[model samples]
Target: MAQMTGKQYKESLKKVKPVIYYMGEKVDDITKHPAFIPHINAAALTYDMALAPEFEELCSAKSHLTGERINRFTHIHQNHDDLIKKVKMLRAIGQQTGSCFQRCVGFDGMNATYSVSYDIDKKFGTGYHERFKNFVKMIQTKDLMPSGAMTDPKGDRSLSPSQQKDPDMYVHVIEKRKDGIVVSGAKAHITGAVNSHGHLVMPTTAMREGDKDYAVCFYVPIDAPGVMHIFGRQSNDTRKCDCSMDQGNCEYGCVGGEALIVFDKVFVPNEYVFMCGEWEYAGELVERFATFHRQNYGGCKGGLADVLVGAVYSLALAQGTAKASHVREKLAEMIHLAETIYCCSIACSCQGFAQPAGSFQADPLMANVTKLNVTRNVYEIARLAHDITGGLLATMPSEFDLHDPTVGKWVDKYMKGSSSVPAETRMRLIRLIDAMTCGTALAESMHGAGSPQAQMIMIERRGSLERKKKLAEKLAKIGDQPVLIC
Candidate 1:
């Protein structure tokens, strides 16, 4: 089949029957559910954009496996250009959605697995690489959305998965059958979990020898028996059901529509199991995936920041403050921060090099640096936005009040920003700023790829401080002269 259109993607969901719960009730059809439709719409654009003439070069790629045209999300990073295009594609989608489109996780997972499996095969004489290649071909042909499921529900911070009071705290292989394995545990805060076609499950962290069972990795259909999802709630998510204007980014929603996916003794056939009992390579897979995923923040968040900066500027205009020096300065600061993020993403991509398995990955040090900057810069950008827009962003009345028949006249009269701009237009822009800057959106920016500390650890490991010190010593003539007796 050719790449799916947005409409086809929506229809495809109708055939999937994942066991999903939102609030307290079972969602019969996620495609039709109000809570999921916005996220679904956001993901669908990932497909639709690829078919558009202008975006085709960035959003679509020829599959290395079959030479067929496929969505870039399913294509492996075959070269440095492919890695760079991945960043560009993310930014474009982020600008279009102004929210998490939720496909990058799986894309990163595929690439990480592709390279790591080969190394594992070389050392252990395993056939994981060939099996994974087949899996990639299938995904490319079907153009399916697979949630990259990592991040286990760790019961305690100090304990390893093997030492945890409850062994099931992290996903582990409970029973290894002749045909395959049965995994039992849960993955928390999984993006697009409820809406995706299946999950590419992976270990959350590095593992020791005793943690072999927890190092398991595999793919399972969303509707696979014993797999169930409990949809997570965003700060203003319920507003999605009630009002349009109040919901902010009403059409696209926020933060990837995360969910808690439980695998209760879910059986998987051997064909879908990419890694099993491969404890030694767990850290390699984790690091590779983290670096690739980290490289994306600048692209996606920078694009989102672009929308936010524009909205703030529009708000200033509506209130007749566009020419104010302070507001203009704040706007300029926001643009600078956003562009700085884009530069980091591009730099990392351009510095990317090929792995042993012939897939390109972003430079590790730059990618970590890129994500660390995102953690701090995006917040400052949001702060400047709030300063320019004022407290009215949070204090605004509901959309219902704006449209209420009895008090509507009062709202229109008092809320008017300028004599020329309609009060309704100003209110709409306020709501957009409110949704983009607060609650779930802000938190996702801080910890989406990994926490600030996670990036710091990688930076410390890869920083090459000793080498840098030598350069400094040589420049200062300290290396040329023998060390003093002192």
Candidate 2:
């Protein structure tokens, strides 16, 4: 087995020197930092599960390249079953952790790179395919976590990368030396960048003829010189430091710990550069990566929905409303939405076929459909959770008040919902619901995989509306008249 234990994973982070800033201060050790530890714990769960007998099959896979048992997070999909298993693994992790495990983006990135690099080689006779295969093999053998960098900070939404007033608005190759290239720009909303072993950086969008500099892709160590990360702030992030009860899902925190990673003239050796100035293939790479990433939401969010449902159910019971007709109906609705997303993920996976490079890819249409529904479904699901939990979710008193000598007794008395359930229990459940529904978790659900409109564009392109119109015309007895326009 080429996998590390949770303890080993945490120990490994202490060796890296990633320059990370949080709340205007440099974080020397992310593993011990309160703001990052919950996310780390969530990610560590992925490692811990692989060591268990029951979860071994779901969390570990036989690497195609090395024939060794490797973490599923590092294995490229070898078949449709592998793809299906990926979703199942994500959901299982989600259920257990009740938060983003923060590894799926890297998993998806490797798969996309595996297939797209082969296609790029076929088109332009580049050796990127072989280089990428070696990279994947190294990742699996070492069990490294590679954060996928795709989203860029678009200074002007309407402008192209080349048109941005700031040349570094999109990551680009500033200097191509004999050894390799130096890239300068920043990748935004990068999930788990601080904790990951390194990054698999890819272009954020398609490139035109003049955008050659921006059409670059490569990998870099997180602690590489000139690479820096500014940690993103989450809702109630400060609560992590002071209030235990108020920090709902305290063990796993909120969504994936995201950050802005800046590449300031970071040098990459030739072996690490997968694509450079491949303007034509940029769109293909973006689509492949984005589709695979979108498919991930189904499993992870489904797992999250499971947690939300459980929290809502617990809160309902705490408030003595679990058996009400309307409550039951709303709970059922939440289940329906969650299952629907999971089904889409599975549908896309089951429908997948092998790519040219022998890696399986989900059906683009179904994957986009899965994500599009996620954009809307997660919100409604959270809405029902909030509806069931009631006003206490937002207006609940801090844990300090519950423990205060002056107000503790009265707070406990009035906060108590039922004699059977403890006041503290009721308050805890309410806090959990509040954090999951109203915090970073919900935002990630809305915009994590290229946002709602991006998924819609992919869906529209894949839909083939003209074919549907043709079917409608044929059914309506409208013949194809060639001379009607005269």
Q: Taking the tens digit of each residue's C-alpha lDDT, what string does model 1 give over 1-486?
A: 959999999998889888998999999888877789889999999999999999999999999889999999999999989988999999999999999999999999999999999999999999999999999999999999899988999999799999999988999999999999999999999998887889999999999999999998899988999999999988888789984788888889867899999999999999999899989999999999999999999999998999999999999999998999998999999999999989999999999998898889999999999999999999999999998888788888887888899998898887889799998898988888888989999999898888999999999999988777777786688757335321
lDDT of 2 by residue, 143-193 (tens): 888999989998898999999999999999999999999999999999999
- Cα TM-score per model: 0.98, 0.98
RMSD of each: 2.3, 2.6
Q: Which lDDT values do the candidates have, in the order given?
A: 0.92, 0.90
Q: Which pairs of residues have clashing backbones in candidate 2?
A: none
Those runs of model 2 whose alpha carbons end farther than 4 Å from true positions after fitting are: 480-486
Number of the predicted model whose lDDT against the real structure is largest: 1
